[model samples]
Target: MGMHDNSRCINCEWAVAGTGQKFCPNCGQPTPVHRIDWHFLGHELEHSVLHMDRGILYSLKQLMLRPGVLLRDYIEGRRGNQVKPLLLITMMSAAVVLLNKLVSGGSLIDGGAHQAIATGQAVPEQLQQFMLASRTVGEWISGHFAAFTLMLLPFEALTFWLVFRRFSRLNYPEWLVISTLLTVQTFVIWLLLIPLHRWLPYAQSLAGLMGMVYGAASLMQFFATRPLLSTLWRTAVALGVFSVTSTVLVLVATIVVTWRA
Candidate 1:
């Protein structure tokens, strides 16, 4: 019944020139065999929905349910089933910014600035001024969290590459992939904890600790052939490098803002 079916091409109104011909010679469109009026629309909608769910939700499920296996599969060239790490991070960043705004009325950065302004003893005049300005600047950064992350990710990836160079066989680009995926995982933790941290500031520290633990586990899985202790120490070094990198980024951004002001 497959090849025997005959139909015209919708694009060019060409007649069914031959049986079993999938595309029209005149228009290069698929032969509309036994298709309803809404068949093309239905097909496109189904494909879009399927692709979105398969990549996004399925990857998230894998990361949550079996992260080691997920990282292993992705790094080992079984990534067709997974979403792009950068895209995942981009989507999560938007969610995180919105959640922060709703929960804290700004961001953790802004909140910290406010707390420092209110409670700090012997704060220098310049420090106080910077914190005051940081409220606005931090809110802007939080609102554009995706852009902030995009800028920060390269440094984070570089730190990972340098720290793990001796321990893992992965090159810089592969290290970037690991950095992206782990950052996406950490963002997921932030999404859960950021809102809670509004009412309970301790949740922020808890989130950081959780992210560190998750990063270590991801490193071990990613360098599955490496010794366990080697993976742990490399993860520790990576964390230290990443912390310094991120702190520098924040400081640089703050200086830029202050300079502009």
Candidate 2:
């Protein structure tokens, strides 16, 4: 253990006990408080302990390896060592957006319109207008990718809530949390696969499928009390609902933006 300035509670100024206490009696912060140093590199880092400024890797590991268990634990109040769900997903969204830019030259979503316009390709006046509007909408969505991702999460969360309602005791907010973590795991997958875009144009598709697999696996393990086959079909149904709803929403959004442009 690193040396701790256990004379007083740094947070609340409460007098310390006999140095064995792991948390402050007043503020409840972890004790034996040492500076964030090489001890951070030691076993003291303890990624499993949640809510006290742990690394992002720990959250990703749990999301990948035991996402259902992690979600259930967080929902049921074992949330000490985990990163905030919103914060984690936002950061992952930013990371995924940045990686997409780096590997795809930031053109993956522009649908080749950017290159066509930039190269002075011959085009009809109507087509030119449409391309410009589409490019603008695409750029805006990419720039605000985190917000865009969050906007889509509600639809998926609602689907999950409705599909799993009978088997689940979780409320809508808890389902939202589960949806966020599951969605961000796809971001984690993208971070791993996006760099391969130079050699694998299909990497994004593969990542999407992998994300689906992870989400299905998470639900299967999470609701193990339900029949496995039932869970599988329900999951598929939930995803189908999310897909149709989100697609309509996106199409409407694109139309609005395109019209305004």
Candidate 3:
């Protein structure tokens, strides 16, 4: 049968057929050999790809040029031309997490001893020890994410209260928008720190550095807009308290996981 025939659909590279039926059975849509019918794909792929292409590039340019400006613009309702903040955050987070896994030697499901033993066969004992000792990339990432929302929600609430207290007219939804921006910023730091962690092998020390960087960034954001000595002092206090709390929680969680295993 020729490529155009339904029987050839399964053999056709473009047609992704499954089950016993032929002729691109998946999605019940006719498969185009050379070109896909735009309407058949529901136009979702086109829309999604276009938005992502434009949104990601635009967001990146803005973020690189003006770190805080994107958040401010988003909060002020200049949203249509740019990507959604949460979507941008999610994409960046996934990319960073994947890169971290690649650099750190793969996923948590890969299993530490198995990977070490498999890879250690030709490698030196010292190198094997190092790989074995390192936390599974999955665990490290999971730990960060699991703690992120819990840790930052309260910090964001406190920040909104301290910084925007006089703007009582701003509703809770407005505070939520601010909080979402802050959360996105935290993920941005993760995008940065993942590479840093690969270069710096001291996990605990790196964790401390990450916490400090996050706190400092938050403090800077607060200070930039508020510009009051009292607000600076309050931000510092709040940040220190949250930093210590987040660190302790992370440590306890890590210890528990280790002890359980």
* Candidate achieving higher TM-score, 1 or 3: 1
With a 3 Å backbone cut-off (N, CA, C), the pairs that clash in candidate 2 are 49-81, 50-80, 50-81, 50-82, 51-80, 51-81
Question: TM per model?
Answer: 0.76, 0.77, 0.52
Candidate 3 structure quality by residue, lDDT tens digits, 1-261: 344544345343444544454346444454444344567475655454455535566666655545556656666787776767556656755665576667675452224443647764676765554444445433664546534554555655565565546633445566556555555555555556556655654443454456445544554553465555655565556556656765566556555555554
Go through the candidates in order and give each one's C-alpha lDDT: 0.74, 0.80, 0.54
Please give the range of 10 consecutive residues that has the lowest summed lDDT in model 2: 45-54
Instruction: Indicate which candidate wins on lDDT.
Output: 2
* Tens-digit lDDT string for candidate 2 (158-243): 88999888977788899899999999888888889888877766665677778888899998988878799998998889877887
Question: The CA-based lDDT of model 3 is what?
Answer: 0.54
lDDT of 2 at 87: 92
Off by over 4 Å in 3: 1-54, 106-155, 158-173, 189-198, 202-225, 228-231, 251-261
TM-score, predicted candidate 2 vs. hidden true structure: 0.77
* Model 3 RMSD, rounded to 1 decimal: 11.3
- For every candidate, C-alpha RMSD to the true structure in Å: 5.7, 4.4, 11.3
Clashes within 3 Å, all models in order = 0, 6, 0
Q: List the residue pairs that clash in candidate 3.
A: none
